[model samples]
Target: MPKSKRNRPVTLSKTRKKGREHKEAIVNSIKQALEDYSSAYVFTFENMRNLKLKEFREQLKSSSRFFLGSNKVMQVSLGRSVADEAKPGIHKLSKFLRGDAGLFFTNLEKEEVQRLFEEFEEHDFARTGCMATEKVELKEGPLEQFSHEMEPFLRKQGLPVRLNKGVIELVSDYVVCEEGQPLSPESARTLRLLGIKMATFRLQLVCRWSPDDFEAYREGLDLSDVESS
Candidate 1:
């Protein structure tokens, strides 16, 4: 003698609903690049510097394209298995699509591509959570780099300092940051104020593909080297 239960409605997860459209766009763009470019590459990046990457893209704007997105979608665009591979053997490249990976499509010769990636680099201020490359100790004296007006700001960043005769002076020696330790917010600010740049932005070519062949690439890859089946 129990009453009938009412039907319940279900809500879809937000990520599933939002990600579909974005994934489709990426797939289309990747497929287009694969079709139009004579050569393709798989790349991974570290400590990405957006402005530097933007400039890099601008440099290659006329001759090449770069795609950064989910590796799963990229693998799907290239075909995850041999039977459905986008190109004759493109499925092989799918295995390399891991980490902060992306696709680079261009018509440039292999040597030129290798050279461009090697020479392209930019240095920037380190951020919080980045490991300090070296220890920094500030001597107890007038810090000429900052003005008297900045004394208060520096103190808030945990530095023991003051103003003297329109100059910012340190009351005692300060350990700004330690090598191999993750940078803290205060330490990063102090390093920036002291003009210490500890981050280098660069691109590395992992592998490349041509219609006739494919190969793994590394810094100083000789023109004679090749890897494909």
Candidate 2:
């Protein structure tokens, strides 16, 4: 019952040195993938949705593995330089692991792999600060889609709405959102309530590697950093 130890001094070394084990685990996993799969590809993602990605991972679990974290650790695992590379000619693939990127290891036919990646896309609700994909406007009329109880909430969200005959009604024309502009917090919430989805989650191939050859899909994959390191 004397003094509290909550404010006592403590070292910050562990926070800086932590995750070494996790990094080693990733490195080992990638090295093992090198042996398990015949081909590897580096890809970039936009607006990631984890639940959807998990479902996707589940679908491909039989013939592939997905690695999506810590670009620096991944670069080290694949080898940043020729001398340290786990496999020959594979370190070049590391350059493309710059931002929002991950690695794919699979033995599926290249055609099948290409088809899967080219077609995989997800649509999700736009969060605040996300760009509106299309303009959304409401006319001056009864919004039969919403119940009377929602009238108060709609007005609070900047909508000119009211209750009419036990239905939510818009008293004046309202532009909930505009195309090619960032959605406000209120607008984003409105979009969700209206069942509108504007965010497109997608993945694009950056580069590919194999035992005998390599292919570059897109250009300028931040090569200078890898070159200098």
Candidate 3:
């Protein structure tokens, strides 16, 4: 009788198992992040390297803010409905998570969030090597189309417009304002003229919280009313 042929059964490798565990851990952390955070802003870092990334993290740490992991992890943790509600109208961000993706989590004052975002914008603008790939791009056409709607606000803010190569520029410097805080009539007008819009995320405010408000503040508020209210 011929000997019977047999095949060895394959066993799972430790390395593969470990990798799977690690991924699951990351996913769980992402889920926790979504559950705990009241607000989050998704951002992608372009050309950001060691020192710059450290500085950025330090800045956020100083303000009690933190960035969570990738969008897939976040989505897995948050589920579609919660994640969609968190960012509202900014679904475009979902596509841009291919790069160094993160979500800025904070329970800080709304103005602080706005201020942080503005600071991030300024930092990106100032950095020669960094670029914003996912930012909201304002085209000349929109500016021109809305100029009539924007002019009154600009005039009220006492900001003059300069025709720079056929583009309008705000003539006056404006200060950042938080939710419920009053903006100088001129500043409000200037903000309007500049075509600033409401944050797509419900948790995101246009301004930071004032130190004074920090003394008794209990919750966050809409930042869109910064100019009007």
- Per-residue CA lDDT of candidate 2, range 1-229, in tens? 7778787988766565556787898899999999999999999999899998899899999999999999999999999888998898899888788889999999998788888988999999989998898999989999998878888888889999878779888888999899999999999999999999999889888878899978777776565654464
lDDT of 1 by residue, 1-229 (tens): 7654665556665464546888898888888988888988988887898888888999898999998878999999989766788887676677778898888999999899999988988889999999999999999999998878898999999999988888989999999999999999999998998899998877888888888887877566443422332
Each model's RMSD to truth, in Å?
A: 6.7, 4.6, 19.4
Best by TM-score: 2
* TM-scores, one per candidate: 0.84, 0.85, 0.37
lDDT of each: 0.86, 0.89, 0.44
lDDT of 2: 0.89
Model 3 per-residue lDDT tens digits across residues 37-97: 5555555554344555566668667444444455665555434442453333233233333
Question: Which window of 10 residues has the lowest lDDT sum in candidate 3?
Answer: 123-132
Per-candidate count of clashing residue pairs (backbone under 3 Å): 0, 0, 7
* Candidate number that wins on TM-score, 2 or 3: 2
Clashing pairs in 1: none
